[model samples]
Target: MHRLLFALDPEEAHELTLRVLSLWSERGPLLEVPARLLRVEDPRLQVEALGLRFPNPLGLAAGMDKDARALGAWWALGFGFAEVGTLTPRPQEGNPRPRLFRLVEDRALINRMGFNNRGAEEVARRLWRFRERGLAFPVGVNLGKNRDTPLERAAEDYLRALQALEPYGDYFVLNVSSPNTPGLRTLQEGPFLDELLSQLRPATPKPLLLKVAPDLSWEALDQVVELCRKHGLEGLVAVNTTLERPGLQSPWAREAGGLSGRPLKGKALEVLRHLSRVEGLTLVSVGGVEGPEDVWERLKLGARLVQVYTGLVYGGPLFPRRVLKGLLKLMEAEGVRRLEEVWPPIP
Candidate 1:
């Protein structure tokens, strides 16, 4: 069944996925689904990050549910948190058809999605409805500027999305790293980043997290840490998908988009280690995290929490819970009590 899903063209596969997801939403999450293959009972796995308590440290990363439409089903799947959207101030069709490609040979994906979303207002409206009924866990909103929006006015777009969706989300992710959007990653520059965050950060009380690209230099990472500290932001989602293709085996490796999955493991871990050195910054490690070993490795390096998107897509519905279970086994073996203890002490 899953193989058939992957066999189709990326766009067709995505549409089929959406249709299947819509059906699941209508039926709602199966609470009694049981942790048959996935683990859900680990006392030592509870964690608190980004001003919110998570039942466990593993979360569903952004881009999985771009419209906030499947909060109930995902939460039921046992994720500690679910970050939704790269939603813009207005709706966009995104780049074009075939923007998403799977590199099965390398267990990766390349997507130039261009932040396509139902616009922030609609996203907020649906989120409000979800909350009104009740969401099973914390849901963070990922904000981005529209593609045609000029870089100078990007903050305006982010602020608009933030202000409009503020009441709906438990947290916010400033997605200045998605390579699909033109000039988006440039916002990582110290001056441009400061300009944007200065305008948008103070307006929201929710824990604001900056999502950065994995390909940043040490100097750039240092500057971003300084900027976040200056703005009084809560944390950073260290290392979004990378554009580099060093050891890729997939034919789609040359695709014109950010590459994510196992291929990104080494560089993403390095970035996590570097960012971990920054005092007083909580880091949510993302990119190339495939299993419990990957999660444990990130925590050892310096991640307060971890998020997975590509891994889930490749590993199927039980990925997050399976990873969490494996994390519990690792913790038990290592005599660790809490996920926080897995973090390396600041030197």
Candidate 2:
């Protein structure tokens, strides 16, 4: 069923994928997988990050569901948590079509989708309705500025999205990392970032996570860490996606967009390890994480939690659960008990 998706164009594949997820939601949670099979060996998999308890560290990354429309289905499939949206303040057609290219050889993808979604207002409505009834798992909203929004007005874009979805999300992710948006990365610079966060705090009451790119330099990362600490932000997702194409073996690697998958593993870990050195910030590791070993490595590098996206595209629905199960076994083999013990030590 997965390979068949490879044959379709990226947009078609995405639509079909959402349809399948919608169908899954109708059937409800499949609890037959058994809690024991889902347990990691450490037995202490639960941790409070961003004021929320994650059953385990592995979660589904944002962009898979831009609108928070499939939270229930994702939880049923066994992800510990799910992030939705790179949602904007207004609906966007999101760049030209053919923006998403798959690099099957390297199990990677390059997407310049431009933060496409139904905007914060509609998404918030759906999310509020979902929460008013029930939720399958915790959901975080990954907020972004619109493609037409100018650089100076960027804070307003983020502020609008944040205020709209603040009530519905388990957490809020400030996405200043996507390469598709022009000038968005510049927002990561010290002064610009400080202004953005300063303006955001006035309206947002939720735990905030700043999603950064793997392409940052050592100095840039240091600035980010300081800014996050200064603002009392809840955590940092170690990466968004990369613009680099090194180590890729796929035909699609040449496509222009942010690259994500197995090729990104090493750099992502390096960033996580770097962030781990910080005293108070929580790090949510992402990028190139494919299985249990990667999850274990991220935890050891100071990531309180980790998220998977490309792995699911290449490994399918069973992947998250499989990673969690394998992670437990690895933890047992290493004689680690509490999950927090795996956090990266101060350098």
Q: Which candidate is the best by lDDT?
A: 1
For residues 1-347, what per-residue lDDT tens digits would candidate 1 score against the true structure? 66788788876876777667655655533433543334485668787777788888888889878998777667666788889998999999999877889998998889888888999999999898788866447888999999999999999999999999999899999999998898899999988999998998888888998999988888988899999999988889977888899788887788898898888888888888788778777889888889999999988887888899889888887777778778888989989888777665432
Tens digits of lDDT, candidate 2, 31-99: 324433543433467766777878777888999899876666676667778899999998998988889
TM-scores of all models? 0.94, 0.93
How much is 286 displaced in model 2, in angstroms?
A: 0.3
Q: Top model by TM-score, which number?
A: 1
Q: Count the backbone clashes (under 3 Å) in each candidate.
A: 0, 2
Please identify model 2 stretches exceeding 4 Å from their true place. 29-43, 344-347
Q: Candidate 2: lDDT over CA atoms?
A: 0.83
Candidate 2: Cα lDDT at 285 = 90
